[model samples]
Target chain A: MTVNELIEKCGFNAVSLPEPEREINGCYIGDLLSWVMGRAEADNVWITIMSNINIIAVATLADVCCIILAEGVTVDDEIVKLAGEKGVNILLSDKKTYETAVAVYEAI
Target chain B: MSESLTFHYDVDGEDFTSAGQASVQVKKNLRRLGIAPDIIRQVSIAMYEGEINMVIHAGGGEADVIVSEDKIDIILADHGPGIADIELAMQEGYSTAPDSVRSLGFGAGMGLPNMKRYMDEMTIDSTVGVGTTIKMTVYLNR
Candidate 1:
């Protein structure tokens, strides 16, 4: 499924949808940036509570289709702008990380 | 190779927010050079981990990417209290990073292992009081 389609179905708040049409092939849930960097596959929907700017770099490097900030985690304006500029999709989810992953799994 | 390109950056240790800037730029540079996606990912992810290690442990460092016809070479040098035990440091779950860095989503003790996982060759030259320099090479053909 595409990012926009998943967002529509899951009711995820779109913080940065620079590549809304990007495909979501799978889901990866992790907070450790280094571990996620290696384990998360390209185009996977990454679910995390990491709100720092480094998350943007990790998303870009891992080439994930989008990042789902779980557990009501919210990033500042600077991060949203950076995600948009770097072409990394950012979505906000009120669910926990596991629930967010399950939601993505069901949607895609 | 006779022809090559080199990119250098000074990693700032003071700000954790800017830790991965060098790797991010390296990714962009590799993309512009038309490097393969998988190869670029390998190089960038490896270098990004190195950058984070430099900041969290060494307070900053120098990173250089030398791109050639056959391989991409990354050199990360830091002037901080070096690793005393290379063997222990390479372990997946061993980390010396402070709690502050751990809260930032790093300090998971997977940095060096992750670097080695992506790169074709890795060498660590560290002295406890002096410094540490890591050289990693990723073959283009791989």
Candidate 2:
């Protein structure tokens, strides 16, 4: 499913979107950026509590389909701006990372 | 054949927020050079991991990426405290990064192993009190 479809159905707080229509092909749950970079498949929906700006770099380098910041993590203003500029989609969720991952799995 | 090009970046260790900037720029440069997606992915991933390791452990470092016809060479150099145990550090689940780093979505003990996994060849030169230097290569044609 596309990013917007997940946001609409899953009820996430849509934060920033460079491409809402980008398709998610898989799901990976991890907090370590390097591990995610190595294991997360391209076009996968990355669910994490990390709201830092570096996450944007990981998302772009790893070709992640989108990022779901879970558990009410607040995002930095710079992160939001960079995400928009990088054309990376970031979704905010109050749910735990696992719960959000499950919702993403069921959505697709 | 295209001439080899080298890009240099100074990784800032004091700011965790800016750790991966070098790798991101390298990715963009490679894209402009028309490097293949898969090859770029390999080089960037390995280089990114190395960059993170330098920031987390070495307090910042220097990264140079040399793009050539058959391969891309990444040389990461840092003057921080060196790794005492290369084999142990290379283990997938061993890490010395503080818990705070874990909260930032890193230091899960996967940095070095991940770098090794993505590169075609990896070599580590580390001394206990001096520092560490890692050289890794990703072959374009491989």
Candidate 3:
């Protein structure tokens, strides 16, 4: 399923969707920015508890289709603004990382 | 002909949130240079890991990315405390970063390993308490 479908069906909130319809070909769960950068395949839906501004750069650099922040972590205003500015899809989920990863996998 | 170009940036150590900015800019510059997407990805990922390491461990550093027809050269130099054990640090699950850094979703001992993973060639020059210099090359023609 597309990112938008994941948002719609999986109950994920699209906090800043620059690419709602982006195709998520895989799912990678990692909090280490560098680890994700090195391992996560392009167009993967990256799930993490990290809600820092650096995430935007990682998502953009890794070419991840979307960033799903699990555990309802909320970043500051500047980070959210930067997310929109960078044109990256940022989603929020109340579920834990494992649940979110499974949901994303099953959704797509 | 497009001659080789070089871009430099001073990574700020105080701001962990902005650690990857240099890598992001390098990625964009490489994209405009008409490099293949895969090549750009490798270069950016390796450099991004280097930039993060500079901030989290070395209190920031200087990054120079030289783009040429044959390769992309990334030189990261810092004056902060250097690696005490290169072989140990290169291990995939060994990290020296503080617990505070770990809370930020990094410091999982993957920085150096990731850098090497994404680059075609990598070398480390470091001295304890003096500084560290890492040079990585991604060959475009390889």
Best by DockQ: 1
Q: Which stretches of candidate 3 lie over 4 Å from their true place?
A: none
Residue-level lDDT tens digits of model 1 in A1-108: 899999999999998999999998888889999999979999899999999999999999999999999999999999999999999999999998888888888888
Local distance difference test scores for all models? 0.93, 0.88, 0.88
Query: Which of the numbered candidates is closest to the native, going by highest TM-score?
Result: 1
All candidates: CA RMSD (Å): 1.1, 1.6, 1.6
Tens-digit lDDT track of model 2 for A1-108: 898998999999878988999988989987778778889988999988777778988998898989898888878788899899988898889988888888888999
**Would you estimate the TM-scores of all the predictions?**
0.97, 0.93, 0.94
Cα displacement (angstroms), candidate 1, residue A100, comes to: 1.7
Backbone-clash count (model 1): 0
Quote the positional error of residue B110 for candidate 1 in Å.
Answer: 0.5
Residue-wise lDDT of candidate 2 within B10-93, one digit each (tens)?
989899877778888998999999999878877888888888888899989999999999889999999999999999999998
Going through the candidates in order, the fraction of native interface contacts each one reproduces equals 0.85, 0.80, 0.82
lDDT of 2 at A105: 82
Which residue ranges in model 2 land beyond 4 Å of their true spot? none
Clashes of 3: 1
